[model samples]
Target: VRNNGGGHANHSFFWKVMSPNGGGEPEGALREAIENAFGSFEEFKKQFSEAALGRFGSGWAWLVVSNGNLEILSTPNQDSPLSQGKTPILGIDVWEHAYYLLRQNRRAEYVEAFFNVINWEQVAKNLEDASS
Candidate 1:
């Protein structure tokens, strides 16, 4: 049940967390928080992509707010940060099923493409909601 529920939540969030018109640096508090945590957006992306690639198997890489600080983590299968008491603000589904049709075995390509569709506004809202 946990796996099923987590899977649903992860996929649901993935859909809402991105947009066709998305892709750009975030603004306002979300941007500040990211920079505060990662030094820079480019660094954050590098780290996030590292987490995705390091997962070792089918899983997800997540950017979550932990204790008022942003963190990057990867979970195997359908696992979610919620279960660990963290609030996920962003994530990438690294499961082959999520991108094999488009990038084949080049997971790095999918990761790069994912950046082009991130809904920064939604992420800012998520950060606000979680902080409150």
Candidate 2:
């Protein structure tokens, strides 16, 4: 039950927050908020990427909004941040199916590639919605 629901929800959110035309940094208030939350966008990326790679086996890494702040976290198996009442604005699936075809066993490379396709605009919108 947990696996089915979590994977479905996570993948739905994941697809919504990525695009082929995505990449580059976010702008305006979203950028400011991320800077405040993680010091800088680069730092946030580093932390998020690290979290993604740190997950062993099938799992996920999330950038979640909680109490008006952002956090980077990883969940093993099919656990979802929603279980803790935190709102996930962005997430990356580190499961083998997500990257095995292109990145093979190099999870680090897959994590790096995820940044290139992230739809920052959508993510920013999610942040706004979650905050309100």
Candidate 3:
């Protein structure tokens, strides 16, 4: 039950991280941070997508700000970065429930749509909060 709660929390944040009008490169501090941490935004996206796609089962892919750096990681089931003492800045739900409604079994397609709705502004805010 607690795990379900965590999954819900993570999923809620994941939904907010995206927007219908969001795809494209991040700007401002988030962009600079991405460049510094992951070499480039493209690289960051590639890593993020790979992590999301690689989850063995229902879970989440995350971009977390930890120890003054950004890292891409995947959480199994309802596990979250909060549990590992990291601050989650962005999250992508890999659960079938999250995408089956829109993309059916095409997880890759769902992953692609993620960029179209990424809320970079909110992500930047999360990063700022995490850093502070």
| lDDT of each residue in 18-106, candidate 1, tens digit only | 99999988999999999999999999999999999888889999999999999999999999999899999998999999999988999
Q: What tens-digit string does per-residue lDDT give for candidate 3 at 1-132?
A: 659789778878887888888878789999999999999888998999999999988988999988889999999989999888988999998989988988889999999888888989999999999998
- Backbone clashes in model 2, listed as residue pairs: none
Best-fitting candidate, measured by TM-score? 1
Worst 10 residues of 2 by lDDT: 109-118
Reference-based TM-score, model 2: 0.97
RMSD of each: 0.6, 0.8, 1.1
Measured on C-alpha atoms, candidate 2 has an lDDT of: 0.92
Give stretches of model 3 more than 4 Å off. Answer: none
lDDT of 1 at 35: 96
Q: Could you give candidate 2's per-residue lDDT for residues 1-132 as a string of tens digits? A: 799988899999999999999989989888998899899999999999889988988999999998879999999988999999899999999999999998889999888888899999999999999999
> Model 1, stretches more than 4 Å misplaced?
none
Candidate 2 Cα RMSD after full superposition onto the native fold (Å): 0.8
